[model samples]
Target: MDIVSHLNDRLLFAVPKKGRLYQQCVDLLKGADIKFNRSNRLDIALCTNLPIALVFLPAADIPRFVGEGRVSLGITGQDQVAEAGISVDEVCNLGFGSCKLQVEVPDQGQFTDPRQLIGKSIVTSFTNLATDYFRKLEAEETNGVGADEQTQSSKPLKTTIKYVGGSVEASCALGIADAVVDLVESGETMRAAGLKAIATIFETSAVLIASQHPTHKDLLELIVNRIKGVIAAGKYVLCNYNCPRSKLDSVLKITPGRRAPTISPLEEDDWVAVSSMVEKKRIAEVMDQLRNKGAEDILVFSISNCRV
Candidate 1:
């Protein structure tokens, strides 16, 4: 804090400019009560409530910005950190934008696993990440990178890299690259591209990255902590239902919250109103479960903020 604030630089943060991840960054900021007016240029958005300017860049470029100290903080995918080979520590993981990095080849290809890729060429936007994964896997027999595995890596990462801008999966049978390294949500696109995932590199999700040399660490972390709280509180609904004393334990299992349920005696001496939170996605199922357990008069409500 002392070192960062003494530098007297305007804090800069980078965000995914445009993509599925861009909207998520915006929603997360807003949920944290961070306000900004578009003013004139939409690309260079500002946070009106804090001493910060948020520059929206391609999601892939965020790690570089933070690494170069051009920006002090960034919201980006974890995959970007490895791809950029940057000097930034992942300070926090913001729980949205989850995806996986995987290797895919034509569904009918002879390749069944990574070992089959020994003499093959691969195309990917993420060359560094793929190289690291394979290099490490090849190290298993030696306990870790010893002389033999070093020779294997030096023998030319047989997997060639092509700078295909998009649709790396479709390049397989099309013959641009032998295999493709790309992000997968459900593997539906890989199948549609006539490919199947042969190996999983890593599970990727959105994260907050910070430079090793930040000029405003306090302000940078204050914003990050608030955004994390917002993410923690998302996707839950507060619910209350009345149930007979005999069925109280069953209803509790259906709608458990951060703490024990709040209970109150109802006008009917044998009944009590039980209040708790049910996850938004599980509401329907929980209600049915509660009803089957003798819960009556169920009420669901939304919560705007929850710190814990």
Candidate 2:
């Protein structure tokens, strides 16, 4: 165990403090019924029943923390992790904060492929990713000189990077840059700025990152299990209904669930109260199907946490 980690048995966890990803992390925890009861102004969160110290940091800094082992765990986007070249292993894909990192250009431009960019300059905030992409695209199957000679070879593919504060979509229209490498969520901003994506560089989502360093194995396992439970619970809903013996088979077929449905006798001898979990978004559809098969007193409730 590292001296630092050994000194602090409490796991250090980092989360994004602002932006879309931060809200998602909070919503996921709230949906799991995990309360954060720290001072309103404080950036640190303490899990009610866990020994973990949560620090809210800038989203872009999360990878650095996880990679350096300053924090034992982190919740941030996959793009940031890759960009930072972090080696932390992913523990979970939270399934939110979905977006695409792409190379986009002005709608009027006819440049569709990398070959056309051989002599052109590309502007982007993701300097590393952009440089890597263009380097490979400019490179060819043949040897450096042979390929460069055989290719257009008119001018070297020059990539100049410029970091704008925000709103990269407008860069193309304003003539501040040729093309932009940025996150495209709904393409609203892109369309508004008369920009169209020419190439998708990467698809990103929120991921849970865990440190590779040694630590309290038991505590780490407990924390992991609890977090997983919270995630599973958010994806499922508890549903219960009464059905006659004749319709039990039909009801079971509709609510087969992740494992098996719990069936118990009701006060009425001919009926049974069967309970199971249905996917959260599909609860209504499943309930309707069960109702059509003679299910009565149908009830749906959110599951707070689950462990398997």
TM-score against native, each model: 0.79, 0.78
What is the lDDT of every predicted structure here? 0.79, 0.77
In candidate 2, stretches whose alpha carbon ends up further than 4 angstroms from where it belongs are 1-9, 27-50, 112-115, 135-165, 267-270
Location of the lowest summed lDDT over 10 successive residues in candidate 1: 1-10
Q: What is the lDDT of residue 242 in candidate 1?
A: 92
lDDT of 1 at 17: 84
The best candidate by lDDT is 1
For residue 167, give model 1's deviation from the true position in Å. 3.6
Clashes of each: 0, 0
Candidate 2 global lDDT: 0.77
Which is the leading candidate under TM-score?
Answer: 1
